[model samples]
Target: MAHADWSDPTPAAGWTIAHQIAHLAAADTNVLIAVRTPEAFDAVLKRTEAAGSRHADLEAAAGAAKPRSVLLDEWRSGRAEVAAALRDLPTEHGFPWYGSQLTATLMAPLRLMEVWAHGQDVFDAVCAARRPTDRLRQIATLGVIGRELSFHAAELPLTTEPFRVELAGSDGRTWTWGPADAEQRVEGGALDFCLRVTRRRYPAETDLTAVGGDAQAWLDNARVFL
Candidate 1:
């Protein structure tokens, strides 16, 4: 996985480390609404929206209030609850998301990826780097979800076949997913790969390999929603 212990200062001036941590913590909490009540998952959607607004307020106020340690504790607790929900939800259970049904087990990694990706925002606020790992493969695998989202949002037809993603981390282990000879192949360091999908790194500024026409463009506008 492409994991990191990053601690660089976030470039978003209004956002502090505490605010980033709290936003992710809040997002994790919002994801859980889908688990406890599949029929009530619309509430989950609304909650994420609410969380975003709340985070905006928190980011603005972060300059004035709260202890760092206390904020960290709150963030940790919120993450724990999300982890528990991800671990406990059964495979047979499904949640409503954007008019679709998603099994909890399949959705767990998405939740994990969200935490790991957003966690980088906090890490950047402190100027640190985490160790690279195999877990990044799991996270980047979600990039396939991007094609669907792009097609939906841009009103263009995009292929759904898995794009081959290969990463050679700073540690030298090559982590890969999908078939090597697939229509598209994306190669880069674990950090860059994660940063790309998370919309943190622009392809030109990073050592990313995107094969096939419009592959990079596909990635450029890739968003989580349809």
Candidate 2:
């Protein structure tokens, strides 16, 4: 599968399967560097920015230079290394991310979210269907937590009032956040909520329903990742 169809473009912004894997591999490498040698990670960021190079551009260039086998091996090995580094770190220890610092625990979930989201792109490229998993609970939780950040990103006023989030998990369990009787509420499948917050799917494309002004506003401008 890897050798025969590496160049096939996916539905995700028309990125090839190799490009999707390359992005994950590159990101995992950066996380490993951030955990082990923060200065090196910072240097990479500075150098990339100085050269006017986006991370996507760098990932594509690197992927294009390597064989499909090499890229897959790197992605597998790099992710293992990142997992090990995160496990070895103290729970309270924090490391630099794109702009902010995140503890090992926080970083781990973000990594999972990236892999799952990008995995969907790869699966779609190969005409494969992936059933949703309970791991989306982590993503849905992150989306709810990022409500304020989303508002800030959209250049909208932050609502101080809390909004309830109720999502049905893939396993049929309900995940609820915020007040039980809040006037503003968002209710839907966990996958839809995660996809919506990640900007993978527009609000209109999902079955998620937003009630009240604040909840509707959040649904319109949700972004779980930077």
Candidate 3:
């Protein structure tokens, strides 16, 4: 990634590779604040909201002021700080995130999802092929749990019935969610499902198979990020 062209645009619309890394760095800094100082995190949220500025906008502005090397250094340092904070925090501690709260355990996977998703943008910018890994199970699980949020985010009706998801992991093992006897089912590759749910790839572009109305609806509206 260091050797890649930071100014090059990625598949994520108007964002460049440097913007993606900067976004992650900013997000990691926010997470660190959320975990270490609740008041500061609240201030950050308030300031961003008051300015009607999204985190991405703030990140891009910040990134534009610095060179790629500085952004890379901040990103690396911010990640290490967040990691250490999460490691030292109690398991029961829940911090505000987006509009809700998450425990240390839950926050870790969300961070991983961001890293993997943004990493995809970087890879795409450089014309690199990204291989699926067992770690994607974390993202897949998050996507499944975000089913209701997906519907809510899209302002659609939330289905009461639970759907089963069976993804063929890169490790050649099936990662299953919900009940096996569920009426609605989603079956596909883990990477495809992750990308679809993250909105990195649309359902029509992926090989995922949805077996019922609810499952199909989920695929249509799935979003891992809140």
Q: Write candidate 2's Cα lDDT for 1-226 as tens digits.
A: 4444888887766478888888899889889888999878888678667767465766666775689879989999999999999999999998887778989989989999889888877776777777898889998889999999999998899978879999999999899999998999999999999989888789999999999988899999998875
Q: Predict model 2's lDDT versus the native.
A: 0.86
Give the runs in model 3 whose Cα sits over 4 Å from its true position: 53-55
Residue pairs of candidate 2 with colliding backbone atoms: none
* lDDT over C-alpha atoms for residue 184 of model 2: 92
- Candidate that scores best on lDDT: 3
Model 1 spans with C-alpha error above 4 angstroms: 1-9, 37-41, 44-67, 97-99, 159-162, 169-173, 223-226
* Best candidate, TM-score: 3
Residue 206 Cα positional deviation in candidate 3, in Å, after optimal superposition:
0.9
Write one digit per residue (lDDT tens) for candidate 1, span 1-226. 1242222236555665555665665555556666676667776666547777564555435522556566567667877876787778776777776457877666777777777776676566556677756777666667655666766677767766667767885557877777877887777787776777777667786788678765665666655543
TM per model?
A: 0.74, 0.94, 0.96
Off by more than 4 A, model 2: 1-4, 51-53
Q: Model 2 reaches what TM-score against the true structure?
A: 0.94
Q: Rate the local accuracy (lDDT) of all candidates.
A: 0.65, 0.86, 0.87
